[model samples]
Target: MELEEIRVAVLRIEGTNCEDETVKAFRSLGVYAEAVHLKQFYSDMIKDEEQRSLFDFHCIVFPGGFSAGDYVRAGAIFSARVKSVLKRDLEEFIREGYPVLGICNGFQVLAELGALPGFDEDKPLADKPEMALGINESNRFECRPTFLRHENDGKCVFTKKIEKGKIVMFPVAHAEGRVIFPRGREEDYLERLKENDQIVFRYVDERGNYAGYPWNPNGSIYNIAGICNVKGNVFGLMPHPERVFWRYQHPNWLENPESPGDGRAVFESVIEYLRKF
Candidate 1:
C-alpha cells in the first residue's frame, strides 16, 4: 500500500481520552487517520453513515485513557465489549498480519483480550488472558519520564527504526502498569518472550543499565516495558508515545534542542511497514 493509501483507526470508547492525540500523531505523518469510536463498529445506535467496519483500515491503535472509567480492573470492560461484538473481526485482523498497537490503558485491553505475548500462532486470540498489567509496585499512580532500551532483534514492526540497545525517554502515566505473568510460570514466560524476540522495550536508568525502583517504574517482570506478539504485527507498551512526537514535547527539550524526539521513530517505523503491504 502507498503511504497515502494507508488508513489508521485510533479506536476508542467512553473514557478513552487519548484518541485525539493518537489520531494527530498519524495525521502529522501525512497518513489518513481518525478517532474511531468503538460503537461505530458494532453498535446499532450510530447512524448508518457513521457506522464502520474494521477491515477498512490498515492499522488499528488502542489509545490510552481509563476506558469505562477503569471501574472493573482497567480494560476489562472495554475488552469484553469488543470480544462480545467484534471478536471474529479482531481475530481475523491479527491473523491477516495487520498492525495493532496499544498504549497505556490500551495495553491493558490487549492483555485482557489475550492478544499480547501471543504464544499460540494457530489461535490468534487466546480464550483467556495469559498476562496482566497489574498495579504499580509503589501501589500508587505513577506519572513521570522513563527511559526505555530497545530490545527486539529487528522483529517488531514498531521499533524497526530504532537501534537495538539505544535508550529513549518516553513518559509514562498509569496506575496499573506492572507486567506480570501467570503464577509459577514467570520464568517460563520470560524465556518464551526472549526466545521469540517478542520483548520490545525494557526499563533502564539514565546510565543505560537496568535498575530497580523508580528506574523500573511499575516493576514489570525483567524490567520489561513493552512487547510484541509472536508475529510482530501487534505491539503494546505502557508509555504514551503520542505525547512526545516532537523534540519540544520532551521534558528536557532545552538541553537537547537539536535532537528529534524518540517517539517519532515508532510511528514512522509502523507507517513504513504498512507502505510495503
Candidate 2:
C-alpha cells in the first residue's frame, strides 16, 4: 500500500477533544485521514452514506478524551460500548495486522478493552481486563511536557522510525494515567511484557535515566509510558503526539525551529510500515 492510499480513522465521541489534532497529524504526512464519530461506525440512526465499516480504513485511532464523562472509570464506558458494538470487527481488524492507536484516554480504553498487553492474538480481547491505568500518584491532572525514552527493539510498528534509546518529548494531560497491574502478578506481567518486547516507551529524566515523580509523571509501574500488543500493530500511549506534530508545538520550539517535532516520527513510522504492507 502507498502512503496516500492508506486511510486513517480517528475515532471520537463526546468529550474527545483531540480528534482534530490526531487527524492533522496523519494528514501532515499526506495520507487520507478523518475524525469519525463512533456512532457513525455502527449506529442505525446514522445515514447510510455516513455509516462506515471497520475495514474501510487501514488504521484506526482512538484519540484522547474524557469519554462518557469518565464517571465510572476512565475509558470504561467507551470500551464497554466498543465491546458491545464493534468487538468482532475490531478483533478481525487486529488479526489482519492493521494498525490501531490509542492516545491518552484512548490508551486507557485499549487497556480496558483488553487490547494492550494483548497476549492472545487468536483472542484479541480477554474476558476480563488484566491491567488498568489508574489515577496519577499526584492525584491531579498532570498536563506537562515529559521526556520518553524509546525502548522497543523494533517490535512496535508505530515507533520504528524512532531510534532506540532516543529521548523524545510529548505532553501528557490526564488524571488517570498510572499503569497498574494486579497484586502478586506484577512481576509475572512485567516479565511477559519484557519477554515479548511489548514494552515500547518508558518515562525518563532529561539525562535519559529512568526517574520517578515528575519525570515519571503518572508513576506507572516500571515507569512505562506506552506499550504495544504482541503482534506490534496495536499501540497505546499516555502522551499527545498529535499536539506536537510540528516543531513549534514544542515548549522549546525556539531551540530547534527548523526540524519536525519528536512526535512526527511516531506518525511516520506507521506510514513506513503501511507502505510495505
Question: TM-scores for all candidates?
Answer: 0.98, 0.98
Q: On residues 172-227, what C-alpha lDDT tens digit does candidate 1 reach at each position?
A: 99999999999999999999999999999999999999999899999898999999
Model 2: per-residue lDDT, tens digit, 87-131? 999999999999999999999999999998898888877788888
> Candidate 1 at residue 246, lDDT?
86
* C-alpha lDDT (0 to 100) for residue 109 of candidate 1: 96
RMSD score of candidate 2 (Å): 0.8
User: How well does candidate 2 match the true structure in TM-score terms?
Assistant: 0.98
